[model samples]
Each structure stands twice: as structure tokens, then as C-alpha cells.
Target: MNRTISALKEWLNPDWARHRSVPPFEAGLRPNRRLDEGTALLPEAEFEPDDVVIRDNGEVVFSSGDGIFTLADGVVTRVATLGGQVGTLLVAEDRMIAAVDGVGLVTIDADGAATDLCTDAELAACVTDLTLLPDGIVLATIGSRAVPDWSAALVADDRSGRIVRVDGSRAEVVAEGLGWPGGIENSGAGEVLVSLGFDHRVERRAVTALAKAGTAVGTNLPVYPGRIATCTDGWWVAAPYARNRFTELLLDEPELLREMTATIRQDQWFVPRLRCPDPYTDTLQLGQLRVHGVIKPWAPARSYGLAFRIDQRGRIAEGVHSRADSDRHGVTGVASRDGRIVVAARGFRNLIEPQKDKER
Candidate 1:
């Protein structure tokens, strides 16, 4: 009922500024083959990964499936098994905190012993990312409270997401009613920047008073931004999925969206994903239109890979891309290691080093 009214309002007088406007790939956010032309770190793994973090000891650790793995001294090994899907990862001194899908937030110490940090019910589902502040306050993002899955929350326009503060073995939701807080990062001034996924912006939130509305730091994003990590100069942000005109139109029609959600397979929905659906079985769009035996890289694609750097003032500084014709799509996680941007290309099922120049 409520969705129908919202849909009516959108259909009757569509406000381009309110929802459908996407920033063009120009200026600092320009598209490039940096992502597609990069090299995968662990091609042997061949499994989708979530978030990544570089430890104080220079080990690159990442979450995938039910385990946390690390790359140290040119070798990859499983560090811990949390018995559930792991998403976000945070490095704190000799310990690492991870968001386990069904088990809640767990911390693994240097000895590889795992312990539950926060068992908050709100984090049982979509725990996206985590960050630690200068004052030692740890914050995590719950992508949605109303629905467990991202696609369902996106289609329903659910704004039940939150920013959770971790204190010892307990956690509290400091901010609520957010349109999918996809990532959280400390701004080095005692404040934090949050990536609101469905909202398509990065917001600056006060850690001392999070229940209040935050100030938008970055807006007019062309994609649904996710996990944010500190880079050499500023910050590295990952945009896991690009906006599609066809999908945006579906959002404007509640009945059609509901019908498609109820009838079609989720992977085949008109929504964006980490990877594209099988071409032979999915609905065809002109974006995939090939001319002269090649699909242009700038063509509107269902799945897109993007990891960009943003300045301190929240302006995009530079970006890497895997466009329509590239198989290296869905850059969901990002981190900086040895002057190179490390990307967790979930669609490609491996970590990629997408930076020029060499330090080794």
C-alpha cells in the first residue's frame, strides 16, 4: 500500500533530481581499464571474497565464505574459520574483527583464537563494513534491518539500516533509519564518514551523537557505493554496482517491481548485481548491443566494477573501472598495500592489484 503511493508519486511527476540522476563518467571519476587490466592476487582461490584489511604487520587479510585468509610473505593461508559467511574485516593491533553472517561480529586474536565481540541481532544479516576511530571507538554498518538481503532492501526502499558502536562484547545501534549504510570510516577528526548505498552518497556522522541526521559529504554517485578504506593520500571507496536506467524505471513502478520480484529469479531480476546474468537466458538490453564485433566499454552494463579514490573533502580524485565488456566486474572491497590499491573483485572471484608503478 505504501509502496504503491510512493510509486504513484514517482510515476505522476518523476523528479529527476530526487532519484534518477547519475553523475557522468568525467573529470576525476572518469572510467578506465585500470581494474580490468590489473592482476589477480590469489587466482588459485577461485572463490568470491568480501572485505579486505591490511594489518599492522603488513599482512593482507580478507574475508571469504566462512574463513578469513591472509597473504603474507608471498603465501596465502586461512587464518581463521568462523563457520559462517564473513563480510567486513577490521584490523586492531594484534586482533582482527570480522562480521560473520549468522554468528555476528567475531574477533580473531594473534593466536588465531576467535571470540564473539558483538552478538547484536541487527548485525545477524547484512553487516557490510567496519572501521576504527582515532579515539578507539569501533563502528560497524548494518546494511538493513527490515530485510536480510541487499536486493530485497533495495527494491523495497527499506531504510532500516544503522551504524553500530562496538563496546567490548556488546554492540549498540547508534544511528537508524538509514538507506543501507554500506560502509563506515573514521575521518581522523573524531567524526566518521558513512557510505549510504541506496541513498547513493557518503555522509559525515558525528560519533558522539549518531542518532541525529548526518551531513552529506559526497552525493550524485553513479553507482551504489560500498566499503571504504584508508589509502595513501585520502580514501579508497568501492562501488559494487552501477545504476541502470531500466532498473531505475522499475523502481518508479511499484506494481511492476513487485511482480518481477515475486515471479522472476533473483539473479535474473532487472536489478544490478556483482556479476551479469547468463546472456543466453536473461532479458536482453541494448546496453549489451555489439557493434563491429565488440561492445563498447562505456555502454550501460548490468554489472560494473569501480574502485575510486576520494579526497579529504569527499570529492572523487581518481578511479578504476571494469566496464560492460569486461569480466572483472563487481569491485566490492578495497584496501591500500605497498602503494598499490588492492581490490576485492567479487565478480572475478579474486583480489586484484590495480595500480601503476612498482615499489617492489
Candidate 2:
């Protein structure tokens, strides 16, 4: 009965009822209708993939909540288990580096031996993503120190995120007071681009300018951006989950959010999730109702998949999407190899190749 009343109140609220508008696609761009048509590289893996990287030897390695795994020729092999949540994966020459929840940055060799590259003092918080530079330097993004969970960090909205530079186990803060930093990648122009998750944009900063302010590169993205990877022509940015209109409305409702955080489970909270286990029977947000046995793909997407290609100038070149009605949601990581773009769709627990040539 309480759930029904809450749903009724959400339905009646004017701010919550209003749908979040997405800007129309630019010229030469269209929505992706067949995002699930690609092949699943790891069909048997049960863990949620967070990031993927292609090694120099043509091997594909991905990090999941369980650990790091490698896929080659339809075979999946376990590399190493971190005993904690793994956030991102990076392959540097012969070493595989990963960002772990409680373990900080770790390196896994070819023999699956795990070694600590950076400890809690270097990270001082949860590490989300890392990038390998040409000169053997590492750039990482720190999400928050108060909470180890990403969802909890978002709910707290403390703005304690930052970017750090790690060299030979030594780490230094390059930028501070960010809004849930997610992805990190070199911009090829003496600067690194980072995804500000809660800010809904990407920013670029130089490594030497530790205390200098950064400039926004990609602004007003529709979804929360995750990992950003360099491609042949430019960079690929992943939007893991769609923005929730109801949640946006409640951002200023501090008392309500505090109560909900105290009472509701992390997975059950009305936030953007990677997967929807029981969308039909679960508590509905304002615009996510099933009407007459029909669920619209564009109506209040809970876990939508989206990726964008941006040119060197940071303009969005192309995009692909999997709507709320599709199973290929939560695209967190993207990589390009030999002219093929591969994405880690965490919601579906598979690797997908977004059809870039398909037109509207």
C-alpha cells in the first residue's frame, strides 16, 4: 500500500511527470535500432563488465566486478581476482593495470600475478579509471573517499572527486573537487580528457597544471558519461545509463533523498541502474509506466545504452543507442581496434559492436 501511494504521488507531481527532453540528432546522425545485433564475446561470464582494452598481441581483456578476464577466439580465461570490485582495465605494453574499489591500482602480469602499483595513500579514494601515457606515466580518476560504492558517491554528491598522476607508485593530485570523475584518456594534445559523471560533460586538463582549472570539452550530454577511449579518428565516449527525469527533480529534495537513502536498498533506489530485472512489476518512476501492456522505448529509460564518437575538436561525430526496450543497456566502456569499434555493454554482460554504417 505504501508503494502504491508513493507511485501515485510521483505520478501527480508536475515536475516528476515532465519528461526529460533529448536534443534532436544532428545532421548525418541517427538513433541506433539494432544495438543488440552484434555478437557476444563473453556469453558465459556472469559478472558485469566495467571496462575493456585490446592488448598489443590482439588479446581482449575486460574488468568486471569479480575480476579481470581475457577473451580470445571465443574462449574466456580468468586472469586475476581482486577480491573487490574492479572499475577499469588498462593494458600497458605487457602489463594489465586495473582500478579496484578497496585495493587501489593493481597490475596483473601475463602469469596472472597481481601486484600493487598504487596503494591507499596514492589513491586516497576509490579509483574509477586509468590511462597509460606514452612516457610510462599513468593518469587516474578518483570518484570519492567517503564511499567506496559509485551509487553512494552519486547520492552523497560531495564533489570530492579528482584526477591524479601516478609514476612509479608515487601519486599526485592533478585536479581536485570534481563531480564524480569517471573516464580518463590522453587528448594527444598534451592534456587529458576526463568524464565528469554527475556534471554530464567531459573536461580537459594538462598534467603539469595541477592547480589550474580545466575546460569543458563535451557539454550537455544526454546520459552520464563513463569511460572515454581513443579511436583511429578520434575518441569513443560511453554513456552507461540514461538520465532519470524523476531523479533529476529530486536532486534538490535533500530531506526526501536522505530518507530514501536511509530506508531503500541501493538497487531498489529510484536511480539510473545498469539493468532492470523486473521493470513491469517493480516500482515505477513518473514516466516509466507500462500502459495497456505496452512499454515505450523512449519513455523514461531506466537503463539505456549510448556511445558517441567525437572528433579531435571534441564535436560529436556519430552516436549509437539501445533504448529502454532493449537488453543491450549500460554501455560503460568502448575501444577501437583494426577499424572495428567494440563496446562493453555491462547491462547485457556482453561485448557489442555498434553498427556505425546503418543510416536512419
The TM-score obtained by model 2 is 0.87
Q: Give the per-residue Cα lDDT of candidate 2 at 292.
A: 81
Error of 1 at 321 (Å): 1.0
Would you give me the overall lDDT of model 1?
Answer: 0.82
Q: Write the per-residue lDDT of candidate 1 for residues 208-321, one digit (tens) a residue.
A: 888887888778788898999887678889999898777888887878998999999887788888887464454556376667877678777878889888887778888888
What's the TM-score of every candidate structure? 0.92, 0.87
Error of 1 at 37 (Å): 1.3
Output the TM-score of candidate 1: 0.92
After superposition on all C-alphas, the RMSD of every candidate to the true structure, in Å, is 3.0, 6.1
Cα lDDT of model 2 by residue, 1-360, tens digit:
654665677789856542334444454225665466666677645767888887766778888875898888878788998857887888887888888765678889989999998885647457778887878999988876556566777778768887788997888887788787888898866888888888888878776774566797876666788888988888888888777767776665668999989998778777788877678645576466787876776677667777887788777888777776677888888888766777888888888766655542
lDDT of 2 at 180: 79
Which whole-number lDDT from 0 to 100 does residue 82 have in model 1? 91
